[model samples]
Target: MSNKQPESPDSAEIFERITYLSGKAQQMLLDFWTRQEAPAALTGDPFGMTSLWPAMTNAALSDPLRLAQMQFDYMQQAAGLWQGFLSGDVPEGAEGGAVRDKRFGSEAWASAPAFQFIKQAYLLTSRYIMESVGALEGLSPREQEKARFFTQQFVDALSPSNYALTNPDVLKATIDSGGENLLRGTEHLLDDLQRGRMKMTDESAFEVGVNVAATPGKVIFENRLFQLIQYAPATETAYEVPVLIFPPWINKFYILDLTPEKSFIRWCTQQGLTVYVVSWKNADETLADVELDHYVREGFLTAIDKAIENTAAPAVHVIGYCVAGTSLAAVLALMEERGDGAKVRSATFFTAQVDFEDAGDLKLFVEDSENASFYGELSEGRGYLDGRYMATTFNMLRANDLIWNYVVNNYLLGKDYFPFDLLFWNSDATNVPAKWHAAYLRDLYRDNLLAEPGGISIDGTAIDLSTVKTPTYIQAGKEDHIAPLRSVWKLTRHFAGPIRFTLAGSGHIAGVVNPPAVEKYQHWTLEGTLPETLAEFQDAATEHKGSWWPDWLNWITPLSGEQKPAPQPGEGKLDALEDAPGRYVKERIA
Candidate 1:
């Protein structure tokens, strides 16, 4: 009897605690439901509604469905609760035990007839008031139809799947992008939904124009970076050597011409090295006819001809980064095959891989079969690959960060804003030609032809990186996922040059955009001597601090002519052109 009395006090206390906890949890559920049901900015037009309408409407209609699900969940949870209680896992008088058991039931309460009637009544009354007011003003049938279309497009764009695939990637690459910890439990549908929302939010807000607003450096030669420059000595004589910068079209050329603090272009110019960078016109539907060779001939080669015509320099320094680096290698290879190296002096490759054998999971869509099928379907009406499609592929790389994070923050949390520069740059997309994308995927990504002596041809000229004897600075990032260190290291072996290999900190973007303020960046050397394989090099590598930019500047400066008062880009010796920072500002796309 005495033992039983103690049990009664414990039971009573448990009941009291459960009552308080259940009430608190019920209030939280109510708040969530109320917020979800609140009116959102929308159009009633059938076509123009947000894509979420379908799911939202269905959920609204079948209130009983949610109720039933909640009830079932509660039952399952209750069973578990009882098991825990019997096993003595739940402490007596604990509020958590009851709250856990009752969570689902609290949700089911919202489906009660009393609650349903009020909700429906409120919706009906609001619609009546809106329609009554709208009747006074009226709308034309055509106007109404247009409204419907707009609404539909908005909704379609907002669909979870559409948002997820907004910047799509192959599923394998997408999975790899998520990393190991997140790869687990990916099979769940809710996980996918979250991923979709997150990606769309991350990708949708990019605007490149903003970053250029703050850039320094005097604009030279018709206000274009990639213009032909006739090199001149300080004594008002044309130098024997001309130089050209072959910037990769993958990213904006301004990455090299960023703000003064981070600007590599400014650094080069200050060093008195004749510099010209290809400022690729942002492609759209109109520019779809352009192919890979157009860039080589009309771009790099054309600039070379102009430089020769202007300065009569026997050779020029052609440098490129990432994809452009490969393109430069290909051009040099083509030049070698035709014995046309007269206009070429030294070549420099920056974080570019001529070899694709170690390209990683980014190669899923690069298979020959995939390229053929994708190109056949995509490039039908248009002559070029749709830029939007290409953008979507890259977004899938980090679905959780890009897709799910956005969804949760923007839609779920009702908070949508980011001030990060990198995210903004990523959101600003550029189009690719259909032929170019297809060729890139098939020839470069899927096939490992470019590295071979006669693997792939450019206008019947085979591309062989080994044939390139340009004095090269092969800069690589130790942590680069896109171009792994091992693959990037292959350029040193392939290029027959007085190669000076450099390793930088961060991934792709940060490595390139490295500013001096980030002084504590760690880089590695070939253990004081450059090695052929990245693995061999890592074993013998020594770590150093500060921006690799300074080290790079020091290495290249000595190669440049002695610096006099900083030659105004368009002043005495060079072409008499416009002022600092030109045309890029007028071109705006958000």
Candidate 2:
């Protein structure tokens, strides 16, 4: 520690520094807007709900009594807060102002009369707006979801936590630092603007193939859609039947291979198995014609073909995650139709949805024709769904964590984010092909056809889930927002084979990526007959303490055939294209 005291910046100096930051931020934004590849015109509505105003308005007015009751309730709550302030006592119960969100948990928010009033007033109004709009009658389920999602977004933006004056912690930070905090915050703002994405972690602290995604492997094959990486085995010998994994294309595959301690790829390699993973291409106009069929054939099927070739194995164990899991189901169905189902030994799905019913908040973005049209125009020129849109929508799903929390920490409190591997992977986004984007949202999410027999066709072959009798294992997150647990459980009903389904203890990312070394989460399994509904599954589930990776390995080892000498890369028909954490995974969205 230095003996010299640090200089405290004065108000005037802080103001000048802030002014410089503002100018820098403006220039950075201008530079970004003037990029050669910037969108030429306003492509599509970001909110995509400007056209729904009339219908929403009519629905609100249709229940005048309900609207009036909402107003009465809000005013009544406001009056209670005012009375408590006048009496110099903070109310602290259900009848009082409710600070339901964790943002206002500080003592200042509850102890100060003025702060208490401001907090309660904001809460009351937010509740009124959300409940009134969300509960409006006569709108279809899709319309209702759109209204709820967009309205919550509007409400979240107005949070007092985002403002320095309204936020108690920000005010304290400004005071203790003599306004230097705001100046630093301004600089952070300018930096984020230049980078074109919000700063969520210490980006410089980690890099692909160095610290994260450091698992040793070799890219044995490449195609226009994806590159297949065959990991170097950690064990002396491996399973006779190799395993292949297909991660979602919406984001990079590195999430599963984040670190030596956390990488599922590394763990699998150590458990005496030959593993091959598909690293999807970051699509652009050059791949315009690439659609769902290409992804199913060139991406999933091609990876399987390569894996089988590398090991000269009769069949391979297949795993798919998120959107990839959805595509994998179709690929299996297609394989069955083609008499090629024998190529797969078994299948595993990680939070993948085969059934789209009650798919949750994401339905808001795709359930309407106008929203689909908006996305079409957004992707028409580019020939792919922009990564920014996907990242933004996912961020909105948990705005409090992914959006506002960072705004308060990085822009209000002026603190640098701690190094986090997952958030870094999240910042690295990927684009979806235009044709695939349209078909996914329309045929599955909107039409709900994939779950219905003969209701959907893939590459001219109608996919029947019942015919997909490949022995299956499925794992889902208990609190998953993207692919609800219930929807994942619905897969057990469709597949005509023995299935083992398990539920982990966290949300989507945390649940699926947990490593046994950390022992951070637990998973549940059923003792007997597989059930049709999530409720039944839960009732019969036996809770297992710790990561589910070990259980998965135990179940799969039996199906893996006997262990044998590990097969080295380039020992088969295809030679190593490159080292592991291959080139395609390194491509970032422009």
Candidate 3:
């Protein structure tokens, strides 16, 4: 009876409900229309999907028969694979088998035909997509680059090894460990999340000045921006002209003096050469306004003056690594303008690029609009680019080796992190001042300014690489993704003095840190002037089996003056404050 009475009295309530429903429906229709009318920019097709789809559609329509034939061929191959699996007969081209990638070498994946089929399908699809993207037309170079990058991201994300459920090895481990591995993996993930970055290496395993950067030296000069270290000489007499190394401020300077056996500084001191390294401060909010000029006048030049005073050397042989090399070129140009070029005897650049035209995949992130916005936001409150941001970007450049490998081991398989020294150094990144980082990206990367005359200025004096007349020695790595060999080769066009360019084996760090005793990788050397093109130079060079360190010593020995009694630590106005691997290198940012 109550229900009937309520129903009878609900006319006004029904009208109100109808009105509300109609309003919602009308708003939904309006929203649909608005979405349909939205601009492409607001639609957020960040992967260049709009361009990719049209190109793909056009290609497929233009050659339907070819597409069908390719699909049919794939099916046939897949069927044959299944047949071989049932017969226990390995397929042709199966010497290394379907699991050619060493990353998937586990018996769980390698011995199983189903997993092998999955791997093969993945590889074929990835190859096809890459080939298609490479052949894409009607898109700008930037768009093409974006397309390729995103395609790679998709391919990498789809790898079976990324998913615990998909990866047989991970599944087996999970079963064997009775789910403890999963718990450990979850713990690792949570720990990394709390830390705001991945742990690429076992950081706690190595301590600065203890097991890792244990090379013998003394911090002779300390400034707000840098601490200059004068290594204790291992030889009775040292070269009259000292060698001052300006390592890239992006990382700790001890990379040059990591372990005694692998330390470049140790090698130099043992060779009867006075070694001085500038350990740059890892900038924080306080040093946010630090500019390129500060790095020049305050950091490098000050170190140069101190080195001269300490060793009583007339001039110093300057060596710069990575971005330090770029700064060195600018410093020399400024010195030339100031009539102080005489202070620098010669210049050597390690894996450094004066011309940023082909700075490799690193340029991609700087070029991306989305990444640019993120960078802008990243520097807003921080006033400096976090070391983790730079570290993540660098790791992405070699995603397979640097990123996914660690992901699988640390997260999926729940294996402890490797205690590799190089990985440790890589993860131990340093922050860069927002102002300086912005300028570097704008001038060198975006504008390609450093390569051109009057493209940039320091202390109101325009920096021209052509004006830097110091005899130069440039070393580039053959497999260096960070600083491509061709990009470094462009340095030859800017310098007026005689150039000695060497192409070493391995990558950015390993190539330079190669010790002769290891006898691991080879290097290439060419006599006379470097050819205009990288290809020509590579063609003309002769390959030598062994480290480039010895060759470099021989090359720079002449430039170093006559041997004299070794100089004492902090002999000049500067006094030794602490041992090698000083406070600056140990400083960390939260």
What lDDT would each prediction earn against the true structure? 0.53, 0.84, 0.80
Q: In model 2, which range of ten residues has the least summed lDDT?
A: 90-99
- Candidate 1 lDDT, tens digit per residue, 1-590? 35554333354564465456446545655654565532121113222234334533353345566546655655565555456446645323222222342211233223333322322232233333333322322334333333333333333334332232221221222233332211222222233233322233233343333343233333344322233332222233223354577666655566665445666665554445555555565555665666667677777677666555544445667778888888788888778777887567666667788888886545644544447655545555566544445555555454444555454344333333655545544544544566677777777887777877888777766677777666677788877767777788888878776777888877666776676666767776652446656777777777777667666666654454433443334453346453333454334233
1-590 per-residue lDDT for model 2 (tens digits): 77999887777886676567557656765765576365522444544666667779999999899889888887887787788778987466422334466777788887767777777777767878888987799887667878888888888889887898899998888767755677677678767766657888998888988998889888889988888888888999999999899899898988999978889999999899898888889988878888787888777887888788778899999999998998899899999999999999999999999889878888777745544666776685778888877898899899988899989999888997799899889998898887788778888987889999988887898889989999899999999989988888888888997898989999899999899888787999986678667888888788988899998898898999888999887677889878988888888764
Better-scoring candidate (lDDT), 2 or 3: 2
Between prediction 2 and prediction 3, which has the larger TM-score? Answer: 2
Give one clash count per candidate, in the order shown.
30, 0, 0
Which stretches in model 3 have alpha-carbon errors above 4 Å?
1-100, 368-372
Clashes of 3: 0
- The per-prediction CA RMSD against the true structure, in angstroms, equals 18.0, 3.1, 12.2
Which pairs, if any, clash in model 3?
A: none
Model 2 stretches astray by more than 4 angstroms: 1-48, 94-100, 367-372
Give the TM-score ranking, best first: 2, 3, 1
Best by TM-score: 2
Which 10 residues in a row give candidate 3 its minimum summed lDDT? 38-47
